[model samples]
Target: MEIVTTIRREVLTLPAAHLGPDNPLPPLRPLDETHRVEDRDKEDLPRDMARQIDYAPLHSLLPVRVRDGYDRRREPRPIDTLVIENDRLRVTVLPGLGGRIGSLVHRPTGRELLYRNPVFQPANFALNGAWFSGGIEWNIGATGHTALSCSPVHAARVPAPDGGRMLRLWEWERLRDLPFQVDLWLPEGSDFLYVGVRIRNPHEKPVPTYWWSNIAVPEDCRVLAPAEEAWQFGYERRLRRVPVPVHDGTDRTYPRNSTYAADYFYEVPERRRRWIAALDADGRGLVQTSTDELGGRKLFVWGRGPGGRRWQEWLTEPGTGGYCEIQAGLARTQLEHVRLEAGGEVSWMEAYGPFDARPDGEWTGVLRAAEDRLEAVLPRADVDAARTAWQPYADTEPGERLATGSGWGALEVLRAGWKLPGTPFDESTLGEEQQPWLHLLRAGSLPEPPDSRPPGGTLVARHWRDQLETAPATPLTEYHLGVAQWHAGDRAQAVRSWERGLRHAPVRWPVLRCLAVADQEARHPERAAERYAQAFDDLGRVRREAGDDDGSWTAVTAALGREAVEALLAVGRTGDARSVWQRLDPATRERGRFRLIEAGLLLAEGRREEARAVFDAGFEVADLREGDEVIGRLWGALTDEPLPEHHDFRMRPTP
Candidate 1:
């Protein structure tokens, strides 16, 4: 018998590129000027002191390159792909496109464990704008698809510690200035692929980060996991935790026949081990497992209704089938819950493999069989203990409630063959899945709204005003109206609109944020500080109410607090800034960006030596070659000697 492990590179040509002038990519906004507000204070200080003060540009912290629409083409291009294979499995990775797993197949049956898109389709679905729907996307840095998702990453083939071959993909996360690496290893004679991940914050200041492994599979697949409860955003945009598998009289484990779409974030139970699987009717599927570090799982399903079908077709090539996502996150939910201290790093390992079931066995049986096989190959300590702990839950009777929390109890109900509540036109009534196209068409008979008037500055604003006047009173519409008013230079009206929206919907974070921005722009520092504080408080309540005790609210609260501190500083209220800074949680204060503010506060307090020390420590971890001019200014202040503006202070440049 022989064992083989090889990796090779190839260029994949996608079929007839969807090229047309109508398919334009979204534009990237310029960096915000307010981010450099601290620099404006330089003029107020004495010449010697001003020259000594360091003013770090926002770019130093977030060195993101925004590619314009012109840089993107919908035409054919030779995409670089990495193919790694062994005796049992083959995995293809697209190093240039987010280092996504383009394909994962079981060799013996030629069964694809992941959904592969025939074309490289980019759509404006991500928070940073461009997103593609297929395979496995490694999300890092701040949430969504991450800024690196549409860009190429560093790739190399290296020897693993165990003397096995490994393919490593890495990149510097622009927003947080953090470095992340993913290693894929296929051990000899093993049927599973081992993925090792590491994220490091080498900078002197702490940074908030997020990580999620989004795996796409065929639509309508049954998902099996041990989560007790799931959190979802309701119609009002509030996060709420509900029973898993079945929530609010609906089955969420699989795609529903309704018109509504569902997106769930599951809170995995506290355990030493965890696993989630998506199986087809034949009980053949993919299983993802990891030890305690990775705990959150998410599911997103697009219904087969008219709007859902339209979005599906618009997002991908016409002939390609629809798919859903099974995501695994490092924290309870998202990066908002994770904070990495300066020079800190976190690492974890996960395994993916295929499993089969006997003709007479259920999906659970297949999962157990796979678990048994994994126990034999992987490290045994934690896995064995977890299996022993989970035996009672697995063996519980159908519909029997367990003493565990809502999340675990829900999983037990799912294990008992619970069916989704039936609808009026369900398969039972129609003898097949019934299409609601006619009903939908009638309901959506209203004509589309006309385009806004030509952009003469105020024209767009007037359009939004008209929308606010006639449209239903919703937080989203009011927020848009406030935005348009602000853009039209009607700051007072924008503030009023935002405040009204806030009063009506206190949970709307964006409205509060917009109000704060309006106040700041209008030079009302006190009002801005108040609004920012309110927003922070609202975020905390939302997270706590949704049971997100794991710091999933980190990003929002951090942003609000930072803005409050800046607003206070802008008004020369150093004492107030210090007070707000002190009130911030340790995790938020530990971030590298916050450390800069702390150093500034110390400088304001005339603690020159302490401030200098802080700056010196920051330089040790910061990358000088990345054009960190601020550090140079700080060093000059401490030494009383002017340093070159663009000198490389590091001993060696980053590779």
Candidate 2:
């Protein structure tokens, strides 16, 4: 079974919840950027640091819709999994979940090298919402997590460098508009698994690209990387350069040594061989090394604090051990994106395997011994040579299709006539979501949904926006134009387009909602609230007249209703907010998110007892963001009662 790859499907019957259909509303504005770092905290900085970490140019999650329609009701669901293994190592890949490496086992010792989660619990971690922890997650696109974290990516069987086969996963990352591939293979008798990654920019201009292969390692291990100084980013969104091994009187190399969660990105010099290791007391754990192009190495630890511990439990099952992340990326830090020039591509090789080093002692000695042992086992020269040997096979066409991903990539490729040699987004993969856009591309007009359904997703890519600009100007076109313009940071034009569309729009709620978002961003909270109210009322009327039997309109209307109530509450319109909440469908109000909203409303009205009761009745918010303080604040608002154990997800030191 040396290096041979055959694709077969198996069901991982974990107690996992479902990622239901995405929210229908478009994410018009950019999310608050988490890459907040002050200049005073830096030591040695890159010359182009300002441009790399500045606000994102393409910020909206358009065409690629938000995946926020999941809940916490766990069932014995069967997850789609694909396996690729050789004699020494057996690897399981979750193609349907961002091509995540679900498990990597060392057959000789029967050890799981990476942290494998016992359950598949979806949380509000991914950029688009639903994300599960554990395994190796491929993060591509902007800062924060990838929009494709819980989504599928195309997978296939491809030839390896040694005339054997390897598993290849490829997808068109919509956020940055770049196509990338990840190829995984294990050699005949090799202990390490080789991963070849490539990102291509087919456009005529440069695109800022971010790629991080995040490996989850057991928290019992001490993380070591070859750097004396590290840039640390905390939940405060502040970045500071601190000494490695020890910082703030804590030996920072150990995962649980700190009291709060943070990221330590090693500042590896240009000449140093790139590698990071998480080794236990006996110095045996996972070690990751890569060729030159993949220059970045980072260690992310969920500290031993209550919030950190709660987060650890949140992502997995009870009585399970926690894990930290040792990641490799294309930049010095996860906060920055490397430049991929037009018509250019960046490719590199990475190897992951079990490492045995000298026993733990002084940090410096342990790191040196670990580095020496890694070199002895899988030399730096061998990594580079393997990359050189793998370049030819990187362009080898995929042999057999094992799984399919989103059709957005196929739409882009078909529109641009791009010749991506190895990663083919075949036309057959195009589904209903892409059909309207396909019609728009071919017929020069995007059509309205059948049977007066709500508007579908909008495309905000430059090419698509240009197409929208040229297409005939109807209410539908104008509404879509507004979405495209809004996504590109053209607020004034987007508003003008939406207002124009409203003049004759038979379906005015979508346009009105866009205007509401624009008003909210422009600081006209009152106007935003009014527009939201109007939008919600219009949508409610549509649902009533249409007599929705399938509850589809109810969900969409309920989503809009939540936004409307929040907008009303922002301006202290408690009564108005209550009215909006009261109008929501009864079943929708029972959701975890809505229940929290219910508590917020009661708290706002000084009904502390009712709010406390809402908390007393245990509820798990499916979309509770990492570092979210709402639950804590609400618990405090219902002051005099103890904060519930389920609600204490604080990751920062209390003020």
Candidate 3:
């Protein structure tokens, strides 16, 4: 297979097209009026001496672009197979559309597209500057040494053989007018667009390159992620949901209000490389932000004002709005590079668009359903203890406890040859074998104390309901709930519960173990991270309370610690998480459990080298035996990729 990559460049000049009615970007304002005096002082100093000065004009240093006009309805010959248009825009498809050179974000807009390079702007300064002083400024400016080019363009579209496919080049008047489009196509659908640009990289070493979709949202918007807790700046309603230590060592609390305009970045440090973010699209979009590979990857969100502040107050600013950035690398962090032996190709793509939260569940439901069915076969004895423990609080809102029962019930129904009572879940949509028995569990929110038992038995159901009520309500509880929710097809609810659990009780051991399981099911990682942190705290506390000489806690603590590290990997926070795991007590570290956890996390992060190291280390404890169920779930959570064909099940041996 052929690979494609985009070289990154810095925007040195501002384009005029971005100054239209919708995008009114303000110029970079100087910190002090005597800007010329400072410039002169630096002009005469030694090159090295002058470089030491932290000199950054938040607006001036930022690359600005303005594109005039661009059409999506036309393109050049031979490549054109068809032309299609709606009242809004046109599309063209060429031979290379699906090949390497395809444009990831290309579409026509009514007005111009001008945005200041956020990577080089004030937000970057505020977040990175406080600690490094000028160090952050210098690193950012130094890396931003790239040339800027602009093209004036107008609209056009080219067609492909398939009705949904199209390819073509558009005319541009300036940088801001570069067109972008979001096309949702059925299988076998295609579309393509081409535009011209000038790019340059200044580093001695060829640095990897990537771009971000600078999208603007209207005043009213709501955001959600699968994370239990999130990084908080000065956003509105920032509260410390999860007590994970902040990188800066400050308090770990989030704001209380829900409205905010500052940039909040979340890092997803796992290997699956899948992500989902959504906003309430019913109202005018209420967000704006940048996506640059230079910053850490994952997701970076910006809104009108601080959480709880009115949109009008925030949006009225000259260049203030909400935004969600899609970066080629981790969000809020710098780009990472992998050194190839000799010949190397580094390719990336940046994308951003309006999304309906409802549809995301529809798209990924197949895998989710399969996972749900897989767990349904376990006997109640395996999970019944957890259920029995929480039944007292069953009167309370099930909170997340609802999910554990749901997941278990789903598995039970499937093993018993049951199915959802609806048309979509029938044999046609999901073959009889794949049909989920849990769908027939309930109609509304999980009823409290109401007799809703699956076909097999009530002991397991009773156990789950009991634990749902009186449990410490920690991360583990949330994780189990999230798993249940996921299996029951309450996708959004499952994610929300997991995030909430992690936020409030991150140090709980159960949460970390379950977070890994839940995130794997959801195809995301942040929640798993929250769970990992809680697990670490839980195991650490146990060790401390047991005293240094306690060997049992040492082994158990190391085991839990390793599991936490694995959870971090499950959610894509391997680098830092691994560092934390490695620092455990030496005795605990000797047990191969840590290595196994490390291997699992590395595998999740796609670090085969690191994973292999841990996998090899596992041989030291090769003779150790684990309960069959633990081994099965551990394997399932770690290698959902090419899932293991047969697990060592107590129920039966494979022929």
Candidate 4:
């Protein structure tokens, strides 16, 4: 059979909600995530394992803005896709969406090897914000979903090791200021798709880096990997080493066996083959194998719980089949980050193909048969050789640009004057967002923001922080400086900087809002409420003075107003919360999130039926968090009415 591979561009239309602009405010607020796995499980682990589990998480997303602007309303939107295929298989990549491989098709069998979503519903899941389920997402540079998940990445055709065209997706991750590239192609007559990933650190110092390739597979399949033990981390905030395949008399390898969402990180021995497969009862499904560099394999199951099922529906249409994630990462678990040294780089190759093994009888036999079949068909040596052959092409300059990504990388290149090979973040990609920073680079000072709104943007990279420290000590400068300090984990100094800015800020609300969040994080509820009230008042005055240029200003007012009401409610300031709510734009008041807030206020005012009435209207909090049970708790407070399916997103066992 002649093997002719081809790559081309196409359009895929889906019902996708626009990923509205990011929130203007920097994320200075405290994170309420459960403590890392080691907090409760440290006593029983090896020293190194425990230490790895204790990796620090970011307190805030300072430089990168929070993406809370998107709403739940969606319509059919045309999405750009790159299709690469051989005679045997086809892969569809959504380059505009973090280069996510949206589909993997076994052409001969006419079966989709991945859990392809029928629609694109943006949710509050990514590290920076706005994430969707399904497809293979390239999780890079952080513990959570990549910020680039909903954003575009530079995509272009590159020379493939097999003398064909490979689709290369490259992007600059803002959080850690790192550049990474992913090269994907299909070899001649090969059953598997080859993916080569490389992350490089151009800085003069070390940087904490994380990488995970997340593949969404059908939930009904039984997951298998080469391991006898695994580390389980659940929303319950506890980590324990459980037996592979089965634990507590439950065969967890099947997604339906568990009652809540959880992650199982397989403890594959260093010398074992690196692979994982999700196969049906007949033992045929997608198998992912990678070179030794990508050692960790994980299974994330949205189990048989009400919340899990509800989330499945929320991410897709009502009747779409559910999916589970089988992941490969650079560390032992997603909880850890590998420190890539200065001038260092990490690269690896992974293959995704169909694995067929029908080893009945015993679990051990099944594992043995699967391993033997995988090694025989596609040995580890071939993957290593693929990586070796792909290296030269990985450095080849991209040709015929297929898509464009954020201008952050180009701005960095211009500012630092660093040269990168293979992946080009061209200067032509710079946009309006980079203008002020470019001015800061050219002129030693940043221009003051026109209005009181958080300066058009804020950059918290170390160099930018250094520049802020040396620039004029203006209110705007101090406000930005505080954000950088907070991102660096110096809460006290950050508060001092914000307060210093507040002393002389002409408008006062910008820095005051930052101070309000600082107080909230410090757990001074009363102070937080008071500060929020003051900040809201100042902002309201500005909003009134500005009048109506467009509807955007009103929207900003509503956004801040919502935050103010929440703060006021936390401290028993019912009247103040009501006042804030009343001041919100009439249209904003109708949003599902606002309706929920209204329900909260009604409950606080002892109007239980009114609160229940709000829920009876049936609303969806577009930004509701994964583990937040606020809606259920609110329902209980109102009446004993059964919790609505749309409102149940509880990820853990009820306390």
Give the alpha-carbon lDDT of every model: 0.57, 0.86, 0.30, 0.86
RMSD of 2: 1.8
Report the candidate with higher TM-score, 2 versus 3: 2
**Candidate 4 lDDT tens digits, 350-378:** 99998888634478888999999999989
| lDDT digits (tens) for residues 113-216 of candidate 1 | 99888767665444344567789889886545666656666566666544656777765565664566677777676677878777776555777677889899
Return the number of clashes found in candidate 1. 7
lDDT tens digits, residue span 1-655, model 2: 3444444677788888878878889887676555566765443466555457653534556756777788777889888898777777888899999999999999899999999998888888877788898889889997777889888899998988887788899998988888999999788788999999999999999888888999998899888888889989988877878998889898888998989999999989889889998888877889999998888999999999888999998888889999999999888888787788899999999999988886467867777787888889999999999999999898889988989998988999999999999999899999998998999999999888876788898888888999999998989999999998988878899999999999999888999999999998999999999999899888888888888888878658877998999899989999989989989989788998899999999988988889878888878888888778888887786786666677888878887
Worst 10 residues of 1 by lDDT: 400-409
Q: Which candidate is the best by TM-score?
A: 2
TM-score on alpha carbons, each prediction: 0.52, 0.97, 0.26, 0.96
Arrange candidates by TM-score, descending. Answer: 2, 4, 1, 3
Q: Model 1, stretches more than 4 Å misplaced?
A: 1-3, 16-62, 65-75, 234-236, 357-655
lDDT of 4 at 533: 89
- lDDT, candidate 1, at 432: 9
